[model samples]
Target: MSQANPDRPDLDLSSCDKEPIRFPGSIQPHGFLLALSPTLQVLQASDNLDDMIGADAARAIGQSLQAVIGEQAGLQLVPEIDAADIGQRPLYLCTLGIGPARHFDVLAHYYDALLILEFESVARASAADFRHLHRQVGDFLLKLTDTASTRTMSALAAQEIRRVTGFGRVMVYQFDDEGHGHVLAECRADDYPSYLGQRFPASDIPRQARELYMLNRIRLIQDADYTPARLVPALNPVTGKPNDLSFAALRSVSPIHLQYMRNMGTLASMSVSLMVKGKLWGLISCHHATPCTVAFDKRTACEQLGQILSMCIESREDANELQFRLDVRRIMVSMLAGLTQSADFIDNLSSVFPALLKFARAGGAAILFEERLLTYGDTPDEEAIRELVAWLDLHCHGDVFHTDQLAALYPPAAALAANSAGLLAMPVSRIHKHYLLWFRPEVVRTVEWAGNPHDKDGAPPAAQLTPRTSFATWRETITGTSAPWHGGEIELAIEFRSALLGIALERAEQMAELAEELGRANKELEAFSYSVSHDLRAPLRHIVGFSDLLLEPSANENLEKRQRFLRNIKDSARLAGKLVDDLLSFSQMGRAALRPTLIQMDDLVRSCIDKLALDIGARQVEWDIGTLPAMRADPTFVQLALYNLLSNAVKFTSQKERAVITIRASDEGAEWVMSIADNGAGFHMDYVHKLFGVFQRLHRMEDFQGTGIGLANVRRIIERHGGRVWAKGAPGNGATFYFSIPKELNI
Candidate 1:
């Protein structure tokens, strides 16, 4: 671990992850670092060249690669770089000969616009038998095919790698998704300390170090206290930055890590990264009690074993999950099928128990549907769950949220972790705060750490990161954790949630349509009641007034007046009958189908005005009628719509000195768009949306008498003809009502 910024060097755990470990600007003393330009000229070299290869590193700068190391090394590097995956995986070039007795194995790779060459002394080169390594890996691969379980395979792997490398202790360390490492399996010498069942903190191998292990595949530290060879130029000349030693086999490690190694009583170590599905799964960590080195050929054998182990782990886990996957799929299908066949999903709550919990592999399940909490199986109390739902509304609203250790993410859950340590939440609806959740019970297990992971040393704050001096096993009993949720379980949960959401959405659509129909029925009922009382008022008043006049005692000889009263009574009765017909028509428009025919709009507008003038009497009015066209429509409904508009125009503008009503029609695209304008006491535009809503009136009945169903009826009539209606208005500026009928509609 490199130190954080000294100015603000607070020892936070994340300091390790943020350390820049790749470009340490140095290499271990076991090898030489020679940074070269893209054209093969040496740009920088390690100062240890004098001791390592008996050459002056200063003279190597600005010099061709052949003149610096030797002609043989240069001849082998060009084709190797071109043929290899340079930036990611380092390529091995042919060895170089400095003398008859002295040979160096060279590796070449490129990054940051610079090509680099690392030369390591070929110590005991002939002893690195490739044939022996081949036999070791071959024997394992043959047995690997027969391996059945991950634990069994891990055990075999630990034994095989320890045999190949001759390390005192070899542990198959597996990392959890949270970055904690657990020694799953191990093989060790008689005198070696056993760490088979122990755990290690994630900070022991920071995120960057773990990433480097992923890229390199194999990394070795020959001696814990080996001196690092410093680059002569410190920085690369071409890039003007610290040389990127990400792919270097001899890259220097952090000093804090070296100290950690010494504390563990390990002088040498080699780590082979275990990658599964392109992610770092764990490591084949080898530790030696004495300073030791494993040759390149043997390290390659170990790396290959790690790869094979990763594949076996994936295959074995898949095999284990196959039955569980099938069961979950079956239960999900049965539940959804039942839900779709039922009128209400809540009626199928019986499945939330053993079946639903087993589907998610949880101890309990719940649904926050329709603002109610429904629980089954073992779960937290209603108070705790309601609190969780509130928190989820802010954090995981309208999405899928899950956690194996619920208390870790939501601290308040600590009180409830015993019964609900894990939670899987899926939002059922974005429109409502509805969700589906699953819970897992606390497993109540003990963990053994190599040392106390949370113990802080008595040293000062600055020394907080100092390596622990103890490797003694420390037992800890976990309280708030449950059985881990597998990726397959989470994925299956998502699919089930999606299928259930489809049902939820379908139900919502049906409910919306039903609600709309109910709303229209209620409004029409209100308008019908208002129309009966209102429309009959004038007619009833006329009948009563004329009869009173006809009953005058001295009017026996006045035959003309008596006849007039009788005619008036007859007219009022006819009007009352017409009002009843209008009420019935308006009430049935919602279900009534269109009966369309050719209609002359210009003639229709004139007829509507002539009828409206009967009620208007001698009021001053002006009508500006534009060229109204002929179109195919329901003549009766269209005439009714026209009558309502003409009547409204005359009534609302009754306050005006000279009421101006304008009617216009024009061809608009594939529809005949018409507008009726009025200079009346117009309403505010903000309430315009309510104008066409049933029984929604903007003015008082005392000012302008109406049943408040006129605009709504107009909308229904126009829409029945496959047309649309809209209005725009501002206070005192008057209004313009427009309606359009599709020109191509045969209805």
Candidate 2:
């Protein structure tokens, strides 16, 4: 390492991610660093302090900081330290002059209760330079605010940083969720070799270095080939360990990084971290073909640029996400329409939400929700799916479970490798064992890399840590795994899951409400059934007696009376059977699930008329049917409702010489209102509410031989469809029965 760091000995060296780059014990040689106690007492100093401070670092240690630096410089340190917030990054305190020409910019920060001071040599600069920098930063910020997207902002940032730092090349690149870096925008000299469009493996930065970048915000390497300075007292006296130079601007970098820089032909470089929501979003990396150093004030301006860019980046990302969600909703509507228009959409989606499979880009999808395993498209057998779901339920501890190589995680999945090589499962309900899963088939493809893909693990190539010098394309054949899932796909999956969960919860609430209403209705039905039984039991007994007598020869002595008795028995039995059948159908309607579909009311009404041909046969029924708009509803139940209403019209209008039954439908804003008006035995408007009551006949049984259950069933069916039923009538005039179905209903 360029710096001597007693890095955690317990780190697993096999992986480059475990490197402790943040704990470097020494500082860069171009500058000197001093570690002091909180009270301004010196605890450690760099070995290079001899030429810089005119004293050996070993002797300088254990002495008061006031005696080490001049009393004037010492006095400035106390007040700056007192007014300073130790929690912040390194703060540039003031400039100190050892002589007429020797001056250094002193930066101070607290690390582990120790005051760390970095002394960077200051170059002479005119006042014009400072004003020009301030103007540039101000202009850049204005442009940044006016910028519309991250891409534009990145290009702007790269150009501005290059202009300010005078670097040969500046590149603004971002990291993907997978940690691979891609150069987004670049500003470089003409002679500089283009590194644009280059992709860097995650191992290039390592894990700890990225973390340090987040904590430190900025890092500078004055000379990549410079020697590192050793610390006088290797270990901190206060903590009894190597001083943590995490916040030190002059902290030495790793030898591996220095070598990597040399390999890139970059003599001097500086990087400013672009952070968004505490994450290292990207970097504004500057490189110089020849050795060069930026003034402390100029570097500070670059840091400010990065800070502003982070906020701008977040804003752009948020806007993009909102637009994406809107797009998804629009696409969902289109896909739903296309599916419904298909000849067999319901048949295809008899299992799960198959439409979302388009977003997953998978072979098939499944749902392990509510203990139901439903599969669609190309998928494994039910037994294989159940085992996979069981394994996920037992082992997965997150909101999602994903793997490209399912066989590696679950051995049993290998047998189902044809279509289930990859699986991405997300929970539909956080409180329950409900999950939505997607599948992918095993894919064989070639993976292209800038270097050896095997060395992408961040481990050293050999005994010594070194970077790959080869820029040649490397390709390898990959097998037994599905294409890797991307961030956008996962986000889409989450959105789909959220919408599914919301719909399920809404349906559950509707069901609960319906169940409660059914309970109350059943109770009323029970009481009504008892009353019907009491009224009909006498006729039932008489019918049985009459049938028995007819079979006897003595009872058939009077043939006319025997035929009359038989007629009475037949009428009573017919009424009883009709009542029983109606009651059973009414009871089952509330329990069965609705399989709704897009229904054309016009076709349905015509179909109902065809079925009622027997009832309307040889009758003088003038039917004036009007146009009906298409709607979505349960066809079976709706058909039953239409039949009952039409039958009632036919029965009531039988008295009219030319019975006129007018059937018309009209759009009523929120619902579609259809009226069945007839010039028949119209009742008073005061008794309209009683029309839908079961067995509540307004007319005598002799006048209209009906059970009065038809209208009640119609009311039930309409209400279940999120609609209403009503009637308008006058005594001896005409009655117009109106029933409405909502134009658009989630049900």
Candidate 3:
């Protein structure tokens, strides 16, 4: 930071004027990335430094990279770096095992240090990895478990998955409360499939398939047709009779499934199941163009990685939920502190939802047994979501539940075949009872909702659903429609719902209280106005009445002197009455609401002219009105503002034989700039401040018939419309009254 100095000129040296250092090499090994200033002071460090700088890398990051890496290594590496080598240019690269703990590859580059770090772990004691995936599963669990804003978390999780798997595409698939599935993120690949923003049908992956996914956690069928299928006995663990193996990892291969994958032109596929409390939540799927296989060891590693990634995603989501609750609390506190009324709060409650969340996208919401069609950001959807509680009042009637249960109520119910294809109705558990139900139009493909794979030899006969009829059906089948209740989208609604629920309710309460306050204030103002009308008029009447009384006596020899005195008294009384009226008008201006109406300038000018016709006719004044555009404004106020200017022009130019007043209007994009110029006795420029002041006049009362409030009223009216007014003139030059009115209100 540059220190402030009174002696030195404030010269900023922050411009992009310096060339940066670059490195030169091929096949760069990742290393401790660092950014340095011209003086070689460390400015930034890569996140991979922990693998290089030992355990103290975080603490020592601020130190010079050259000093930390040692002199010999720095000198050898220095000559390799040049300006030409920037983002991708690399230096000394080597993969070395540090101790017996882990293996890492280091790459020194001019732009930054790149380091590739890999960790190895056993497959069976994979609790840590499972925990990580559990976190992700937990994240999915949280999606179903709690109402929270997971936008931030979902984005982060998507990014994390993309980073970890090195897969071209990775997406979060979610099952709607209705058991429909949809894709959340496409995480594009090289020539990434245009599946993004596309929908898929629920029947693409049958109930048997989804249940198997939940139990397996990961399904790595490198080539759907080539991978050996696991066959298990149909005998149930608890019963001696044959039972379904849909949820079993050892199910016989369905030939139709293989054919379907081949038809889709997908050579390989891998997916990590995301489940909540043993129920299938969704899946993280990765696709490959060429036929490939994951070795058992590699498959296990990838699964563990998936698990870790999932857990991190879930943890991050939980953190975000906490933050959202905090934010809602903060906003509510601010509103409560101000003592606002509940109704007023409700009127403006929608504004509280952050702009990032497209609350209007939510189609309908349910609370308990009541379902309500929603209009963006209305009362919290919790009440509406609660209405559906009656349906989930009990668990599945049979011990075995599957997608078959949903067939009776939901569309393409076969899509939920994971458990039994609708076998598991939404449970009436505590989580469901306390949660909100958000329904949207599913707009993307789901985990198991594979598109028409173009071939039929490898597909399973039972896996096929009836062919779609319309393009919309094809579109939905390809993308996977889940009643639009996507995991991320619904997660977002939950987040916003939870955060804004309390604040919105509290604001409503505050708004109601504020309304009462406003009513009381209005009543008080009316009382004050009544008293002023009575009290002020009493004295005014006395002055005028007494002056008239004195005028009645005209017989005395000194009658002329008496008459002059009476005239002076009468004149003073009239001035007072006019001032009182002007004061009342100014006070009323504050209470008026803006009622913008289309006002033709020509009409407004003519109206002012008609009002001043008697005076103009008596004085023999000439007027010039130019072409004007139509504008929106308070017609009455605009007319009054114009009238004062034109009348002033007439008064000031009374000495001229041909007193000319010109009214002209010009459009200025967003406003109308109107000018009234006159050949008048313009005053000194230095005294312009008194022009629009109440009771402040430039001329004596004998020469001008002004209460000094006319210009004041004009200025106020123009300002109320977010416009400005000013006068331009010299002592001898004529004056121009210029004011502007906005085309649109700032609000």
lDDT of 1 by residue, 590-616 (tens): 554567778999988987887676678
Candidate 2 Cα deviation (angstroms), residue 18: 4.4
- lDDT of model 1 at residue 358? 70
Displacement of the residue 196 alpha carbon in candidate 3, Å: 3.7
lDDT per residue as tens, model 2, 374-467: 7788899888888777788666745467889999999988887789889899865433456678899999876445466466335655633455
Query: Across residues 403-508, which tens digit of lDDT does each residue of candidate 3 receive?
Result: 2234355444334222222121222111123223333332443333344333223445442232322222232232323332223333333333433333433343
Report how far off residue 441 is in candidate 3 (Å): 15
Q: What alpha-carbon RMSD in Å does predicted model 3 have with respect to the real structure?
A: 32.9
State, as a TM-score between 0 and 1, how close model 2 is to the true structure. Answer: 0.57
- Which portions of model 3 miss their true places by more than 4 Å? 1-194, 226-251, 276-279, 288-291, 338-747
- Report how far residue 362 has shifted in candidate 1, in Å: 3.2
Best-matching candidate per lDDT: 1
Q: Rank the candidates by lDDT, best first.
A: 1, 2, 3
Q: How close is candidate 3 to the true structure, as a TM-score?
A: 0.29
TM-score order of candidates, top first: 1, 2, 3
Per-residue lDDT for 732 in model 2? Answer: 68
lDDT of 1: 0.77
Query: lDDT (0-100) at residue 527 of candidate 3?
Result: 44
lDDT of 3 at 3: 23
Between prediction 2 and prediction 3, the one with superior lDDT is: 2
